[model samples]
Target: MREDLTFTSGGVECAAWWYPAAGATTPAPCVVMAHGFSLTREDGLASYAEALQAAGAHVLVFDHRYLGDSGGAPRQRFRAGEQREDWRNAVAHVRSRDDVDAARIALWGFSFSGGHVATLLADGIDVAAALLLCPFSDGVPRVLASPPKTVAWLLPRALADMAGRHVTVPVTGQPGERAAMNLPGEADGFAATVRPDSRWRNEISPGLFATVAAFRPVARASRIGVPTWVGRCADDVSADGKAIGKLADRAPRAELHDYPGDHFAPFHGELPTRIAADQVAFLRRTILA
Candidate 1:
């Protein structure tokens, strides 16, 4: 069963869904999950959470500050540092629960937040394992891949947002558009993950460009000492697949899986189920063992 709840993170209440492990007799392992850039827990995370819960692991899926049902000002603001803090606090909250095994916590992140998992591991958050799907490990490749015109159009808006202006941009659009993710097939792939009842907005603060460009989670991969499963989309245009491979290689105990299709492929169709099966298997071998 699912329970809607709130947890304090960064001085605000972040909305979350807690799914207790099915028929667990003892304190069970827990997986703390959150979505990628500009998304909420309602977008496409419930499937994975339910799968984990069915496999006898509690799941805590939450929205970051300033988005979805979370309590915060300046809605849709995406800050990597603050989001990481939210992840840390979520872990702490789960660990404080009597129904969860404090020593057997795992972190699950997708797309942009996949990088957050790596950074959190590097910072020595006492998690047992990590599951990263289509993680944006390095931003340089993505910056270089952006179309020249899109870059030009986004630069001014990014600058304005950095200079205290509330400039906003589309999260996804047609190729050559000024949106943050505008590669071929990206818009459709992102749309496929959105539920009809989801309250997710397409707009995000333009300052996200600068944050993403400077963020390089792959650089800290070698510092992660726990078991990590890195799943990459072979044809992902949103996040660099090659860099994700390097992350797996650099991480001390990481296994890499390459799925078919683009960055958003794992969120829809039969792929997500298959991926979740693989993840649950990994969790069973590691945290839940």
Candidate 2:
């Protein structure tokens, strides 16, 4: 069953969906999840959460503050540090639930949030397992992937936003546009994940560029010290596959899997089911064991 819930993070109330484990007679393993980049919970996350719930794991899918149904000001802001704190609070909320097994909790993240999972684990969140899909492991590659012209166009706006101008930019756009992600197919890939009823916006604070430039989760991979499953999109342009491979190698007990298509592939069409099944199998051997 799915129930709407809210949790506090950084003094803001964040919205979430709670999927109780089916037929659980005792405390059950729970997977804590959130969306990537400027996306919200409704953007293709329910499928995986439902799959995990069906496999007897409680699932909690939440929206980061300032996005989706969450309450926060200066909407569409995306801050890596604050988002990580939201993940921490979400895990803490799950652990407080009487029906959840605190010791068997797992962290699930996609794209940008995927990097958050690694950082959280390295920072010692005490989770038992982690599932990352097309994670943005290194910002250097991401910045390098952008066209020089795009970078030149975005930098000043990003700096202006950082200086309190609050400049907003499209999260994705045509190849020649001045947006965060404009690589061929990236805009369409992101659009495919948006549900018809989604409240997600296509704009975000330009300051996100500054955040991505300094965020490198791959550097902390070795400190994760937990069973981690890293799913890489073989053709991803948004998140560097080579950096993802490095993350898998550095993570003490990580298993790396390659999927077809680009960054958003695992969340679209038949891939979501297949990918969720693979993740559930991993959980079966770890969190749900």
Candidate 3:
């Protein structure tokens, strides 16, 4: 069963989708999920949330302030700091619910917000546990290292943003037209999992590039005292796998799971379910212990 919910953050009402644990009556452990850059709460999160709910955990999946179904002006504008606040807001809302155990709450993030969790840990949010899926940690370095198709448009756009110029880059054009971050196989990767009706494809504001460069989560990860798990797609070219591995090494309590596939493959092709299972099993042994 699923329900719609909302919470206030930074004076804006943020929206979220909630999945209740099967047969759950009393308060239960809950996982609050945050999505990656340019993705709405429904893009690929529903699968994981539903799987976790079936595995006996409540799930709260929310959109970032300025993206998707959430409340925020200037759609698709990326703000790392504000997004962090949104995570805290989502957690607080989930914890306040009558059917959730405040002490047993877990933070889940993928890609962009995957790194956000690291920052949250640095801030001492006190979650029972945390999960990172193909997270991006050092944005500045990664953006610089990104392919030209990505850097070409993203860098200039971010610069335009710095000068207070609102630059709009095309989301895509030709069949192989790049969407800033689509690597050699990324277009195909996106096509595989994204439904034809999915509207997530787009060129994010150049401001997003600026925010990414200024964001750094790896340095703060070591401060996390909660048990942490990092899942990686060994073949994920979109995200910096090496940096993710480093985050696991830096965290006080951490483990790494290297799945055998590309980034989106793990989101589909038998991996999302497997990853969910691993996440639930790990939470059971670590947080539920």
Residue-wise C-alpha lDDT for candidate 1, range 1-289, written one tens digit per residue: 8999999998999999999999899999999999998888888899999999999999999999988889887888777889999999999999999999999999999988999999999888899999999998999999899898888898888888888888788988988776988989988987888888877899888786765677899998999999999999888888898899999999999999989988888887899999999998999899879
Clashes of 1: 0
lDDT of candidate 2 over 212-246, digit per residue (tens): 76789999899989899999987899999999999
lDDT of 3 by residue, 105-157 (tens): 99999887898888898899968999999888777666766666666656777
Cα shift from native, residue 177, model 2 (Å): 1.2
- The local distance difference test score of each candidate is 0.90, 0.91, 0.79
Q: What would the TM-scores of all predictions be?
A: 0.97, 0.98, 0.90
Worst 10 residues of 1 by lDDT: 205-214
Q: Clash pairs of candidate 1?
A: none
Error of 3 at 100 (Å): 1.4
After superposition, candidate 2 runs with Cα above 4 Å error: none
Model 1, position 217: C-alpha lDDT score: 92
